[model samples]
Target: MDVFDRMQNGYLYRPEDPNLGISNTEQLKKQRLFNQTADHTILKRMFAAFGDGSQLRPPLFSVWGGQFVEVGRDVKIGPGLTLVDDAPIIIGDRVQIGASVTISVAGHPVDPTLRRRRLAFNLAVHLDDDCVIGDQVIILPGVTIGKGAIIEAGSIVTKDIPAHVVAAGNPCRVIQQVQVEKVEPKMAKSEFEKMRDGSLYLPEDPAILAEQQIHMKLQYQYNNLEPGDPKQAAMLKKMFADCGEECYIEPPLHANWGGFHTHLGDRVYANFNLTLVDDADIYIGDDTMIGPNVNISTAGHPIWPAYRLKKYQHNQQVHIGKNCWLGANVTVLPGVTIGDNTVVGAGSVVTKDLPANVVAVGNPCRVLREINDHDRQYYYKDRRVDLDE
Candidate 1:
């Protein structure tokens, strides 16, 4: 099959194909204009299929210009939606999609050989009518969500869900069966509810924006202070959800929410340029030393191009155990866990979980070896560690 046919058929194909690149660029350009303009009339003319009374908020990110995306009537979408529509995305009537929600129909092969060839695949995603997709939810390829389903915030949907159920958690599962209760149209949902419940809510809400502004000022103050500031520790404790004693994060630390969602245990030390994309909770255990330029990200987007164009995103927590050392330029993706006493080599991209007391390295980081007796005697291959000071 040709590349485009393969994509539609869910067969692996090279995404770097020149034809695909050209198509992607054109789609992105259209999406850019769609996001910039406020006129609903103009947006309706751009999509492949847009139903009556369906409106998507601004700052939407998508792929393929919604050519393979279809939206039903009277659907209200929150900000920062992302549609990765390599295949097809079908959203039904009266749907409410929370801010930063991602729905994708594309995925990379797990096989290293195939992945190395830049191979990818696409599958269709269908969200039935009257569905509520909470904020920061990721709907993967080939998943068909049933009608009247509620996908809670921060969940990752990998499989099909039955109709009329509330699903939640990482690798989302059915939480409870929901019953439709008819009532009068209520007032706009509060930002706190959106953030707390994981539904798409407006960040532009004055209360929410005000809080963020205050946090930014605090971050600026922290970044500008000298290394010897006595009040630094107190500042950190106040800014974060929970921060333990003797923790030192080097200056120029960057966090999207000013580390408000992060929790650091005792005696943690992070070097310069430690960037935390802390849209959700991040827990770091005691004595974990983070090296320079380390990035820990909690946000992820769907594989579907249509979802990306809508700017939808999800956030997952990251856990790092005690006494671990993350080497320079290490990048940690969402929902990864690293066990205690582990050493990650420089420039490693941690994609999965790692157990304690091992040395891991490389892209999609894998365990090279267990920490053995040799490490005790030699610092670096015959360079003896002189502990007798």
Candidate 2:
């Protein structure tokens, strides 16, 4: 079987030893080659500010600054994937991400008061090792995926996913357990040499690279102002009145925005192609970043069905706290609160409140674990910078 198949189905040649598969040198070489190519593609997207080349498989598309985030090794990011990390997004090793998937780690509130003022909030998303995410899924803010979990395609994850389980549906749930195996293979010396020497080509242009950087900075600035800055604050209020607090309006390169409500706190970042439907309040905290194509909705339809047809709608409140990271394409629904130092995984749909210092991921996002020193050390080491210092 091909390497991709092996990675998906596991390395087992027989049913009896499902966890065991080919361990030859040739197979290892092939995997390495695939990884190198994939890494190159991910780097080309450049969606995060703290991204590492050793962590991703390539041909990835980052809508914003995806190059800054940190990703683990053997992680597969499929085509048309979006990671929005206006905050930090931390991914673990051997994570399988499917095609057209989105991991979002930031969001805003829907409250009219906050929205009118152009205030935005953020939550973090985190994913552990050996998690498999399905295609076209949306992960919301403040979610964490446990080890060896599976998320079905087109599912909306807003809660936490336990380890060794399968979750699916619109608001993803725990369905079953997952079985994993290891495999190895041998490769030709020539192929191995090519992979090692890096004979691959990725789109490279200084202008585009510069633009991406500039965009990230501008977006950061858009979310960083305090209410005291009158000129900027007045502009922010006007912008919020015009476009809501969490709207994702692309700014022109090298241009200063007069008035719009977009503000991120210290150490906050997001992934690529993040579409913020900020018709309301959106607020984020310090040291938090979002993933690619993450859609944060501050506005929701009426549950009564009669109000659904209305052209205008009310807003909800969305809040994310400090030192949190969100995954790719995560969606945060209206009126949710995410506490400090949390992590959310990819393709999750957040529909509720998440407490401080925990890992939560899935539909209707739940608390997975309390944040400890280990979690802090893994994601925050050498990454946070104090501007005031």
Candidate 3:
């Protein structure tokens, strides 16, 4: 039998076979695009079988790509998602995967001779619907995670985890059975409200963590883009929830949500090292220009040290109005707003709202002067505008 046929039958086969290598090479190309592309729907097309509304967080390392992968509806996978999909990987509906989770289906033979010859076997991994896999969890070959199961963070799942149980630890075991509460849909607290209401909630909650992972992956792809690539602008538009026309941002842009929580208006230009702490919405109006090392934050934590251990964070929106210019090394704190036609001088820290038509400077930025006729005549001090030219 051919190598592929042997692989299907779970028999020993040369992984380095020429035909297999070619097939793998092609899949790798697709996999690269799959990981880097802003569109998650492309992943569904790449896999052997995929259900509707499934999304894979990028930088998703995979062996033999998605050739043997099968996913069900609404499967949300987090960043650093590694799948050794040499064998079948069947993931069911509504599976929430946390960041840095590894799921493998391929294993090497214990025999020395087989190991020397670079031989391996694969077993299908089945994750039933409504399961949650926590961060940094490693799921080994042939493991089955039952429906509604929860695998805690930093766990290594070596065997099957039965339905409706919470599992944790290395070589993970069942910690406890999850008691099902039949609460009304209206009574259940939404994740968005839990995040925004300043309430102490689980940041590592599968749904929330999955969103974080997706953002990180998209940011990774954006950061790695070569300068002058035609796809850069298009990719950015797709990555962000709202990016207006003619907006340009230099490389090394950092955001917690990969600009997903950021809204930029038309013709906004940001220099390098523009860091956005966009936990909540950050709005920038049209024709705004931001210099290097600018940090605009919307996320803040509690003052109590003990509360910090629980990783509780609160978010507030930051707004910058139209035609503003923020100079280098400026930091805008949470809940701050800058008004239209404003200028924030270099190395300024904006902690409070600044009104329109002013030149602001320094830490805890204050208005130095409002826009006047003299300011309009000169671009800088004594630099007269060549209006005739």
| Top-TM-score structure, candidate number | 3
lDDT, each prediction: 0.83, 0.56, 0.83
List pairs with backbone clashes in candidate 3: none
Q: Looking at candidate 2, what is the lDDT of residue 55?
A: 36
lDDT of 2 by residue, 2-116 (tens): 4323322323122122242333234334334543464465353443322343433333444234533567776666545566544456777767776556787656556776565
- TM-score of each predicted structure versus truth: 0.52, 0.35, 0.64
Q: Which digits, one per residue and each the tens of the lDDT, describe model 3 over residues 1-389? A: 77887775578877776777777777787888876674766676678887887766666778777878888887777656788887788888888887667898778899999999998777789999888887678999889999888888789999999988889999899989887562111112334445655454456655566667877898889889999888888978977878999998999999888998899999999999999988788999999999999999988888999988887787888999999999999999998999999999999999999999999998889999999988868988899887874
lDDT per residue as tens, model 1, 135-229: 77899999999988888877999999998888998889998987667311222333444553435334454444545666778888999998799
Off by over 4 Å in 2: 1-63, 179-389
Compared with the true structure, model 1 gives a TM-score of 0.52
- 244: Cα error in model 2, Å: 58
Over all chains combined, what TM-score does candidate 3 have? 0.64
Error of 3 at 256 (Å): 9.8
